[model samples]
Target: MARNKYDVDEVLEDKFDVNQLKRLLAYLIPYRKRFVSVGFMMLSASAFTMLIPQFFQKVMDVCIPNKDMKGIAFYSFLTLLAAFYSAFSLRYKIKYTNQIGQQIIHDMRYDIFEHLQELPFSYYDDRPHGKIQVRVVNYVNSISDLLSNGILNTITDLCNLVFIIVFMLILNVRLTLVCLCGLPILAIVIVVIKKKQRTAWQVQSNKQSNLNAYIAESINGIRVTQSFVREDVNSGIFNNLSGSYRKSWMRAVMFNFTMGPSIDIISIITTAAIYVLGVSWMINGETGITVGVLVAFTAYIGRFWAPINTLAGFYNSLLTAISYLERIFETIDEPVVVKDREDAVEMPPIHGDVAFDHVTFSYEPGVPILKDVSFHANQGQSFAVVGPTGAGKTTLVNLLSRFYNVDSGRILIDGIDIAGVTIRSLRKQMGVMMQDSFIFSGTIMDNIRYGNFSATDEEVIRAAKTVCAHDFIMEMENGYQTQVNERGSRLSAGQRQLISFARALLADPKILILDEATSSIDTETEIILQKGLNELLKGRTSFIIAHRLSTIKNSSCIMYVDKGTILEKGTHDELMAQKGEYYKLYMSQYASLM
Candidate 1:
């Protein structure tokens, strides 16, 4: 297997980008009303909370001092009303915010998936499946809590903090000023610690993505590992990945743990100073500072620090989310390398005259794959391409399907340049069957119908029978309804190939491409499959890439490709008569059989 060339873990820079955020907020436009409703409820809840301290101050300074029972009862009832308002407003705020958050996630996930579909094959060629899976599943999910509760809670904290300061000043400017003496130090600590936490979290996110990629690759290739008896070696690799994740997480935790203590120490020293100053004012008779006023001041200080602590914690959460947000936005912003032109038109139902007009192409710069290649397959003709491995045979067929665009020249079907037509229309008329057929998790009947969703039960059965898969399928316990499991692991390679053939035949596509479709099957199965393939190729232009020269000997035209160019083109006998590259390949296969 080729080593994965992609670097899955990239260090993040610019923990926050306002432009990326503005783009993300576009998904929430549809839910603006819900956001508005949540904002209002959040502010109402904060206001009601602010009223609680005032009630406490009044009861301490007035009701208790007067020994007034009615006053105490009235204040208690008012406090109860404030509590009720706070609770209900918070309930609605949480409900609305969560609704909006879920909606945004849904939209964002859908858009990411759609964008993945539109991305070119080359994009996936170098990337790992696990990294993409993490972005779509885990990274996208990471933002849910931040969007739903974090934003509104942060707003509420700020409101409470501001209202507390205003109330503290009205109560006693001197005490309030004394209580906030440590404010500058607290602010600086929070800013410094939060920056460190954000960088730590970025490292953690990278570690997480790397771990996920490893697990996905390991699971997908478990058979190879087991065959090679490398379980211990693989396990050691997994341990290393998991250990990195743990180390990063703990490093982040260290920063998180230190924050609470640092804030608390500052808060404690500030509270002690307030007491010392207020008591001295009373003892010296320098001010009318009663016990009630002193108690209220202490209570107000607690109120002020509570939001400060809460905001600090909220900032921690926001920093962590920013890392994931950067990754999510990066994926959504990826450009679709293959897209239709502005004036491209839908392809009419094709007559399947495929022509490669002196096409040249390369997967990467300075390394050409197909060099000035050209060919034509008239409607209803069978063209066979035989080549050594990596000779660009597959690339040729891929160009015809428009899976990748050419560097120069054009591919035309019935005199229409494929690039000039819409991708959906171009692909709809083509049916492709590969050697390693990808069988999705579904019943055999459903898999066949995947070729043509509108195909009926009878049509599906007919297609299977034509490919000689019906007999073996019926031998199974569930007949057509037998489950294939993931990648058709339950079926033999030959059976999978037959099912793929049946699927292609069912589509009745105008052009059919079979890339070594018979390579996996035994000779007996290939003979049966060949008969069905002959019938299927009767009315459609077909291209076959085969190593078994005998299977394509009767094709209308044969091309021998090598090193990014066509070395020979003629009927099989015509090439054999020339006794060149085609003759040598055919004779080599014939000699092997003997």
Candidate 2:
């Protein structure tokens, strides 16, 4: 319920969903045989435990009375064997349960990650990355024990409870009924606290997620926080989120602790009632009662309540796990908004004739990003799109690559609608270089080869040479094999861009779209990159967006876009001659240099 600068907690479910547990259990269905074996092992252990109390009762009633040493030794040996077998059963039970549990965790995490890969940019756009990560990691781990051991243990405990009840009835019907008196009272405690406990845990989960989001956000922006001296402010916010999580955890556990003691109180009161009544009845010369029966029945009382307490603890865990299950399943259920449509075929080899026909689109309804935008670019032609910030230049390129579906109208490549083909096939022949210039952690060679997996080391180096990245890379001791971390943190901005450029070109795409790709590079590198582009653009369709005049002056066509519309379009010389918006932007840059 708390909000901070970095994140807001997700909404809590108003009611417990039975289907979530059913679905969680469905994951175990594949290994039901293993779990079934666990159940039998657990039952056998309980049986052994039940028989121990019987041995004690026999010694007290018959063996001791007769002073029979052989009988005592026989029962003593049987008890040892029973304890040994019970321990053995439990050890194997734990082993199989853990193996099965880990596998289920692996499956759940894998499913969530695979689903995440298919999810669209919009899905990530709406939620914090840290929140999504918690569901995949922390939330899944929280329920691992429950899925692997808790359900089967609960079932086995219930069976143990039933067996104890049957043996109690066989001993004395009246005392059995007295024990039953505690059931309605214990059920009342559970019914009262179940909803409150579940709601508390749900809030706890949300708070933890919020705290994780802020922590992740802070770590990613720690440099900015330090540079701006916002560490104290950020730490204060973290403390508040951490405090909220602590409070919610305390509240949830308060309810969880309530269940165990309530069962204990009921058990103690019921046992005392049996003892008082049994003593008074024997004094009154009851024919059906005996000392051995009383001792055995009391031992059974201990056995009876043991499982009840275990069941109560299991119930508390179930409530806590249900909260996590809600989020994990919610993510898995997210729609893949940008996935390939049914009946989609592979796109034919591209010759790079791209067209947009009245391609109006919006990220949100009623607020268009690109309004009735239409254009045609023939194969081997380069177009320069100049636009002010938020003028839909980036969105235009995103739509061209089918990162999102257009709201209305169609975008065509080689006279075929892109939506008619599989997304993988459509994007395979096109290269996209965005402003970020992300570089993964690896040898420089591996990072360049990422977009084009089949490119040999020689080809990778060739692409690097074209983008003028080869010089700096070769200067390093390892040349192309030099290690670089994520985002190329060890490299300069210009070097990172050059490496990214090489990566894009290595794909040998027929249609290349570069959105502010050269913005990070220095003038010297940009000039060299321009020379490479002249040769590369000879047979490929290219859309280049940049603010520098040198980057776009030689383009076959220049488009000046503002407020989601193209204000002017022509060759650089023609737009300059027209003295339009493009002329004003160019003059301003020229004046700034002066």
Candidate 3:
């Protein structure tokens, strides 16, 4: 429920984070050479284009007037050659820049995914999965164009603008001066639009994230919605989110669209003024401005404003991308709280000697899930943790596996501090089967083999049989090869649990954890499952968290936990004789059955 965020754009941080953009530059460092080369190519192409006006001036002012056909033909041929090379050079520039963008996206996505894998369970506990999913997929895709052509184009155009201005000044400074006057009006418009455009886009990005969160949540809970006949209500909520996103997008684009037209209109007005003023000056025989020079000057004016238009477009893209980059970099910047230390060492083969020395932990600060919980399980011991829901039964086993670091204490395996050992090595020797059995979309055999990739087919089948999964599996047409999607929707709850149990067994871990692993399985199946688990659990320190006292009666020690502390601990008969919390819990279940 905490992960379900239904609100749309509830809290919008309108300010742009420049640090995120600076951090993103690190991804470009590796391909800086390619980007530089692309810029160089674009600049070279612009240089050839700048020559076209000179070609025009020569024909209008000298070649045509002298009636020299050879000179006219030569300039015409040169212009054609320059145009062809300009077009050819631009092709490679576009090709290589986009390729670099794709590579950066791949690297960034991989880093986010890798970090997500290492993040603590608490990271996922606080945020909707859709919010996280958008950053890795949609948000990364949104910034690719900004990285691809935006930077190179912005830089190349400015350089080209400068090159064009120098030529314009050489032809006629009076007209060039007229063109410079437009820059002030364009600057004012940009200053007016920049803040509004950025703020709008940030809001748009928030609405988009909210919409995706609701969509993912809806899809995941569609069955429940249909069962409760709440489809209409759900659709209404979705429509609201979709409408909010659309409105924000329209608002953002309105500001972004203003940039290009404003530049274009200012450019044309500036051009007209120059032409009119130049003609009058020439008509009055003042300033010595010629017809050929006037024609070339107007052409240079077009070249100059073209880059300003490009810059306007680039600024728009930069603002949009910065909105997305904030989310993307935010994910990359997330800390991995439970991770291996720099000096951590790989754990040797586990002999199942696990000890919790006054371990205290909490998913949230100031509220403990397990307070000062200390226990020792020698090799081959089975410890059953029984408690009311939310009383830290599952948390005990979660700590044993170091899924979350202890807030105030340490956990040890065979006298080695778990925090000092590499997490991959520590977990490799442990098998955990939780209440939720997440089956990825794949063949059943592949799903089981996920526990241990090197496991052979024979080993996989044997593990499946140990949990009574092989029979139902064989009943299917494809048996072991049957395709089961994520969460194993095609399989019944018990069948999915059996496969997950088999996956744990396939890992052949020294320490086994079963937290309500049999809750969905029927009593008959559980009896058979227990029989196999009893033998497989031999010489392995196993922690079983079950409400059904019948399953844990044989545990070496049964701890009755409540309110983050153990209320009772002993064998079933010992606790029943003591008539403690464990006895009361067992009797209540017995009374219900009777």
Candidate 4:
């Protein structure tokens, strides 16, 4: 069976990956002062906590026994003072850590999103949106606690355990040794359980990614599902995915819960053994063990186990976070495959001459989409490409726009190799209107202004008028201010096409490309738009791809393409005189219309 998109690598290392942690810390360097302040606060809080038992021991042994009420009050006041200091330290620590963590998240998210924009179209073509979305939004959120509180909590817990150990030894060496006996057993239990915990968490993460990917894909294609009456089928698939997620999460939770009980049992047995040994020693008059000393030892023992349990929980969280951290780094580390050359310069204003000198290209190796294709268009000429489906019509426009580089040969503009010019400068001079007129979620006015950010409202209105969209705009409830849903689902296909046409016109580029531009427009609207389009194309180099026989009948030049090869190139009358592929196609379509 083929592996699914959500199958996360099962054998990824579960240890505390030092490199990942180091890279994550690089995001913290900007807030180093705040982070250091948080560390100092944590240390102060731990110190206060460690001192509490000492004060309690003094009260029991010296103050209460002797009925020294003044001493009792003084020591009690000290304890309260330590607690207040601890609280003060904690308040600043939390405030600083939260500020630092939130800033890091903001910077990291911004970097990821900006890098995504720099990546080429092929990157998006090869991956599912949901998988990328999860990495950007969900996986990034998983590390918030690990960054803000996890480090400080771990350090404080370790310090508390050490202080408890030292105090236990001072109060009574024999009892301390009994309590320490559980250390080796506890280590064994943690080592065994943590591996299982990490594995379970990794599986859980994969399951969650799968669920997210499914939901996003289904929602986008809901119309197809409803059309086919496959709602039941989709629900079944979703149930299976959700079920797997539940199972994986439960397995991880069980492993997490198992650690606490296992440690508790060992703790109880160690406490019982200490009591037995200490009581016997006191009775024999061999070991000088006082009641107050035993009380203090008991208190230290509880304190020691508290941190140990807390550390165990932290270890589990660290395990889960490590899995998520690796996922985040994978995306951040992806190489920018398409980048400008170091010495690339801005392209000068175009004179509208474009030439392809034996250009050959392919989306994948060993399968060419354009085979040694060569063409040229002079300034102010309307060049039309007419071909069957998959004849590389759209690919020609993509190459002109440098959406993808040619596999071999050169594409030149005004005798300059396009590859030597800066991409932004080259693309800024061309206006493209693709067959799929994708409209963003915004008002109709905003959508039209997207092509030229600096275009004024007057320019937008004029552009809409040129495309004959002004009539429909006034008929709408809000005129130009009407809201468009995502993908323009609320508008008809022809309206979306007209909006896109207006966008392209607003740019006022020297080169204009219309790839099946009038495909969605009704016959009447196409006639109106074409009259304005002809006037607009008078002084601009234009590339038109259309299947309708009459659409390109009067072009300056026409190329009939098939199987990535141009079979005929001529004017309409010249091509009809030759009686070749173009003539046959034109005559067949004309007969159908008649």
Worst 10 residues of 2 by lDDT: 1-10
Per-residue CA lDDT of model 1 for 208-281, tens digit only, reads: 88889989989889889999999999899889889999999999878877777877998999999989999999
Each candidate structure's TM-score, on Cα atoms with residue i matched to residue i, is 0.95, 0.96, 0.97, 0.92
lDDT, candidate 2, equals 0.88
Q: Candidate 3 — which residues are off by over 4 angstroms?
A: 1-4, 8-17, 592-594
TM-score result, candidate 1: 0.95
lDDT winner, 3 or 4: 3
Backbone clashes in model 4, listed as residue pairs = none
Candidate 4 C-alpha lDDT tens digits along 1-594: 012354342233233468988888799888888777777787777777777777888888888899999988998898898888888988888888887777888887787888888777667776567777887888778887777777667877797788788878888888888999998998998888878888888888778888888888899899899999999999999998889999999999898888899889989999999888877787887565866777778778888898898888787778888778776776676667566778899999998999999999888889999999999999999999998999999998889988888899999989989888988998899999998899999999999999899999999999999999999998999999999899999899999999999999999989999999899988888888888888779889999999985778889999998888788999999999999999889888887666
What TM-score does structure 4 among the candidates reach? 0.92
Give lDDT per model, in order. Answer: 0.85, 0.88, 0.88, 0.85
Ranking by TM-score: 3, 2, 1, 4
Writing each residue's lDDT as its tens digit, candidate 3 over 190-288 gives 898888998899889889999999999999998999999999998999899999999999999999889888888998899999989999999999765
Rank by lDDT (best first): 2, 3, 1, 4
Better of 3 and 4 by TM-score: 3
| Residue ranges of candidate 1 with Cα displaced over 4 Å | 1-8, 11-16, 286-288
The 10-residue segment with the lowest total lDDT in model 3? 8-17
Which number leads on TM-score?
Answer: 3
- The deviation in Å at residue 375 for candidate 2 is 0.7
- Measured over all alpha carbons after superposition, the RMSD of each candidate to the real structure, in angstroms, is 2.3, 2.0, 1.8, 2.8
